[model samples]
Target: MTARPILLAAALLLGACSDAPSPHDLSEEAEYFEVSDNSNNTVPVAISLRPIKLDLEIPRHHLASIAHPYKPWAKTIWDRVNLQVLLPDFQFRNTQNLAEFNSQDSADVLRYRIGGLSSDQSFVLLSVNKEYQEVDDFADVHLRAYVNRRKYGNQSEESIQARQPTMFVVNESYLRTPSEKPIVLSCNLRRCNASMVIPASNWPEADRVDFGGTQGVRIEFNYDQKYLRQWQQIHNFVLATIASYIHYPESVL
Candidate 1:
């Protein structure tokens, strides 16, 4: 009942004052690493329309002789069509499909509460032989998408790697801005590919996307196999929307 008792009492009081973790926090709850922040309760919309600068060295004689369609018009159409028409259409179609799919699913396999869409333009450099002569007019944009879900708690590293969440990429044609109908060269560096692990689940934070300057719609959905399978349906719906715009060039242009 000397210094030891006094010290113990002080320690007990300090411990009582410390904040304890909530039950939910202690449980194996999934972490939400935001790709897009819900700004003021409004759906986040990011549109990046950087001026298309062609750093080409075409000869003055060739430019005058060859009837190359005005380069400005290409950028003009790309910006106008994507922002004004195509993007909104895709957004609407995707939103509708998401709502319909999520509503029917009993597993709650989607998590895009702060819903949003983004479209951007940027030049991707390619290194091919000078003789290759690939028309590098169109921009190449790579789209990779992922969502988060809780693992079954205490998963081994190997299991988590094997169970990694599937990252989806929008189909290639959608990447094509409304340009020449008969595409001279493929606009994409690679074909539009979706992750094999459908509805990719249990992804590490390293795979989290930077929604900043991101183009295209990002959907956060559940990782359940039954629910994840529906993603293909959404992808097809988006593809169809883009196809319509592509087919009816006049509508978009």
Candidate 2:
């Protein structure tokens, strides 16, 4: 994922706190941690950098027993950030297993996977990070960097000129946003790419948004190219659904 390196670097720069609460203490809040292997005394902890609550209603059967093996920390982050609820063609299933932790930067990093349950190879990989300052500047700098790399990266002048027409470029006006800035995205004919967070090549079209000001939350998600037309709707649904789950304490507000 393109966002991994950036997230890791940011996390390293921020660093983890030595006095952070233990897994046992945090587990008392049943909604956050999942206890899977009692025999081995292995407890997967769910750490949140922000003082927010997740309010998702998931069916008991749909809740995953085992977390996705990638992060090895938590079973599931958000129960189901489902796209099917907004569109029928999107038969995606979320493998609730993922990891959450606080970086030294006082930011929380969350990674999870949602993919097609049946035959289609459609999926959305999402990453959420808490920032101390405005995230727009962070996203803009990376978006510009991606554009420059594609335009001027290691290539002959002739080859670069030849591919100029097909090269991806930023499309700031593609989506309308009344409250916040339009997500930063660059698109060619085949696929689109976002800055800061890069989705796997298999899931090409991507976009990211910063819930600016004190909200301090930045979200990036990438999905298959087939759903490119529904990018705006998909973006809105994802943002709204996730935002609904996050409730900030009065002090943070």
- Name model 1 segments beyond 4 Å from true: 1-155, 168-237, 242-249
- What residue runs in model 2 are displaced by over 4 Å at the alpha carbon? 1-13, 18-50, 59-88, 94-154, 162-179, 186-214, 240-253
Instruction: State every prediction's TM-score relative to the real structure.
Output: 0.21, 0.36
In the range 4-58, model 1's lDDT, one tens digit per residue, is 1000000111122134444333323222211122332233222221222111221
Cα deviation in Å at residue 92, candidate 1? 14
lDDT for 81 in candidate 2 is 28
RMSD after CA superposition, every candidate: 24.6, 15.9
lDDT of 2 by residue, 108-184 (tens): 22122222111111122223222111123223322221212133457785664343211122234554322223344
In angstroms, how far off is 140's CA in candidate 1? 24
C-alpha lDDT score of every prediction, in listed order: 0.25, 0.29
